[model samples]
Target: MWWDIVKVLYIATRWPWPVEMGRQRMIVQTLEFAATLGEVHLLSFGDPPTKPAPDFISSSGMLEMSGLMGIAGSMLRRPLLPLQSHLFLNGPATAAVMEAAERIRPDVIVFDMARLSHLALAIHRHYPGIRLVLDMDDRLSKRYQRMLTNETAGDLGGTFEARLPGAIRFLVPRLKKLLLRVEKSLMDRSERRAADVFDAILMVSALEADEMRTDCPGRADVVAFPPLINELPVPQQDFSRSVRFVFIGNAGYAPNAEALELLDRAAVQVSKNTGSSDTDYCFQAAGKPLAHAVYKKVEVAGFVPDLSAFLAGNAVLVAPILQGTGIKTKIIDALEHSVPVITTPVGAEGLGLTEGEHFICVLGEDDLAQACLHIIRSPEARGGLARMAAAARNKGLTSQNRTILRDRLTFAFGL
Candidate 1:
């Protein structure tokens, strides 16, 4: 049978709308690709994020998201399972999945992230003939370890916080450091389990994919895929439109929150180091505002509706991420808009970007301040970095690279 004849079932932990995080963007991008190959049946948790469900989705169903109490009870009942798995896949979710599979009669089942790997396993157990594809996204275990090493694990806030029990919510801020220690172990175990079961595992980061191949129980091949980017920003010629240094990310995310703090201090350092007035050094943030995050220098722009325009007006993206894993999508967003970036080595990881060419990699607030001064004072440097980064980004996001992932998905569906 032709690849287009293959029906694909995607069990999304959440609808990839209100896309505040990179993982959510991953879900939408993967699903869009799946839709291009064939009909995609989506069974997502909670309500549809947007109205007039996307045209790529052939059909859709909403599964009830587990409440905090129910998830806690599930964790209590199933001690062996990762606590996060209760919040993701459970007995009811498995049942719902089976019912959807029966109706769709899909040949392939696809899901993203380690938390939903339990669903992949459950579906495979029930229907051994259906091939499973895991879009594992990032190496969460490594990210957790990075946070632990940097002592920023407590910043692990997410959209789910609002739903957490009052006591747990109150305690989580203080307890996150300990919970991350436990979660790192769980995520490692989950990655191994998924690697052992799934037929195809897709990772956005080539570096992480290689690491996974070395460490995990590999029954199936683990492939690294370039991040899917369908939206191309209008090309900009000018790199010195303004002196603004921007950071784009969701504050609900831990690494973003961590970066926000670093940027706040970096902004102040730049002012003091260069004796630059507000006109010479403007630090701006665009995305979900971090609550109670007192920033002495950076101005929170909240979610900018026109990111392309905003990035065009701002000359540089300063993402001094403390620690985390996975390709920084915001850097990609910045480059696409022809905006140069100044980020930590951690922020630049897995993107195959080069320092002093594609982006300026800095280590601390002092270095960040120096980089800002260098860029703002040198128009040649600003223009050169943005041009090089834009060219590099185009090469990275080429269809040739995406075709590897597309072929992998098709082969898995046929299997």
Candidate 2:
């Protein structure tokens, strides 16, 4: 603690009301930890909360700056300006943010997500002395670029099954690629700009921080904002007795939706290939409802009220996330709960947890199905994975993890 108290005015691109997704979790956790230092106020680009906010939020307001025309104009102007700038630096939002800042007049201003990076810079211009921090959470530019490339490869040589729809799909991919290219370029520029402007740039992992520096050069004061588990759930004693494997995440998001689809298809394949009926094993996915339908055997346990209890009770967590950037908070949550996880390397990135040590990492659907079967069949393997996860959580991501973030902030602001 550098001072008796330090007031922070936090701004976010989206309202993290329910705190269901990874970014929301990060924002909430960061605010909760920051409250330990001093009072925190919030301004977000969404409808204001219907009810009172948490105690940590000294005050809050909405930045309803985007309308249909503004969004379309932003898209149209993306090639001319940074996408984030056009989206967030519009007249209304900027005025609202600056006005809020003027009223709050805090020691520090924290912006959540790259969309708000421009807002942070604008705030700094008005209040030069206030320390600025940008919580990027993920390298979104890289994510969009990767997705564009993947889509191009997947759809470039497509056959016209339904001629009109197929042609439309083909054109859509190219259009998306063009748009993504603009976004990537804009995002890169914005990252560098944020690096130069903000006092600190926060990433979810060290790897992501290093990557950001490649473009940002000397000015990128990137800090790793790894998750903190306040308490690790008591490890489930037996695995053989447990019958269900669970996957937890917001399925409305594309990456998690694809993962759920993969799980569903894999479960179907496992049934046919292994001569085991759906009754042999159960896969329960708990989170937001999937955008697409899943196999009957793969149950959607939408929005589990008590995630801790659900995670503690589940035998294994199947996180077959094939695409996405940043660390999957669900995986970390599972680990903190001592639930063995099966995931791909992409899902396990930045965690530094070794394959077959903290949890099993498998490639593709077949390998995933086999891994699940192995866990179901062998309690010893499940227990072993659970023990390793518990050890890793205790060693790295416990309640004490908050100190790391607080220290980083202290250093950033010269507190």
Candidate 3:
């Protein structure tokens, strides 16, 4: 760890106070990591938290946002900019950030995600010598491209929908594939723009870091930052009776919505394939649901407060993630909690874990039900695998990795 850190001005498109959801958590984690390097002052969009922060993490800055009309104004004025980049473009926001920058004279300005890449580029233009960074949590282009190929989408729920203007929000669910293709193309350009401009680019996956390096060689410093997990008590074990088959994720997310459907199909297959007449293994689900999707023989709990407690023993995290780009944070949660998991190669991507040794990895979607049966039938094996996975996962989170990450960030900032 460094003894000193550069004073940083961190910016985010989302208001990350009172972290409750997945994206919120990611934003907060990024802020916290930035703080580790030096004093941080945060600037973000979205309404300020109605409640006081939960005394977790914080920054002092005004909350500024672009209304629908304001965004439309930006689009008309800046015809050359991509349609999606307009979401974060605001004249008032730039003015406020410029005011803050002049006052603080920060060593580095960190922007979160490609949505803010252009904004960051503009900010860096005014202060050319200051190091600039883009903390892209996931490659949106890769995610959207996969969404198109798989044709997987659903209502992104109120939380995500609120970010869009009225017409875009209304049209998005109706025209999922078309909008995704557009977003995919625009994001591909945004990715390249960020790669070309920023002094450093932060990605959540190692493979993505290498890809970016190869695509734009010697353009910028690129490094992979592991997903930051909350420090919570390890979930208590409970391996008894019929194992609780579970799936966790925001169903508003297209990939997760598809995964829930896959879980249901696997459950149906289990009923038909099982010799017993009563193949009544009712599955449990935690997280938001789709706008309209029925869960057959599954107990759906929408957005549980205590996830670790809910994911108690006899609970197997079944993630049939057929599409998506970044590491599945939910799978990591299960591994950390010592909960057995049944997933596919896509589900287990990026996370350096062995196939059979860590978690049960199935080949095809059809093999999902059978994998669940295997985990259910062998209680001893499931427990052993979960324990081993947890051990290896924690073991990898060592000082050496931290030292390497610290060095990369430091070098990127030219410290």
The TM-score that candidate 2 achieves is 0.87
lDDT per residue (tens digit) for residues 1-415 in model 3: 2465567887877777665456666666666666667777777776676654333234456546767898789878876565667776888888888888888888888887888877777777898878888888778888777767775544432255767878778877787777677777777777887877888887777777888787756577897876643334666665544667899987877678788888888888776776652223458789877767897766788888887787875577888888877778887677656677788888878777778767788865578888866655665755575576566456435421546656656666667
lDDT of 2: 0.72
The residue ranges of model 1 lying beyond 4 angstroms of the native Cα positions read: 47-52, 229-234, 239-241, 276-279, 398-405, 411-415
Each model's number of backbone clashes?
Answer: 0, 0, 1
Give the Cα error of residue 399 in candidate 3, in Å. 9.0
Query: Weakest 10 consecutive residues, lDDT, candidate 3?
Result: 51-60
**Where is model 3 more than 4 Å wrong at Cα?**
1-5, 51-58, 155-159, 229-240, 277-281, 363-365, 379-384, 391-408
Q: Can you write out model 2's per-residue Cα lDDT over 188-287, one digit (the tens) per residue? A: 7777777788878878877898888786775647887777755654755455455567788877677777788788877776666555332246788898
Judge candidate 1 against the unseen true structure and give its global Cα lDDT, from 0 to 1.
0.76
Task: List ranges where model 2 is wrong by over 4 Å.
Answer: 1-4, 72-79, 152-174, 273-280, 398-400
Tens digit per residue, CA lDDT, model 1, 156-260: 446666655576678767887888788788888888888888888888788998999899967877877656654466555455545678899998777788788
Compared with the true structure, the alpha-carbon lDDT of candidate 3 equals 0.72
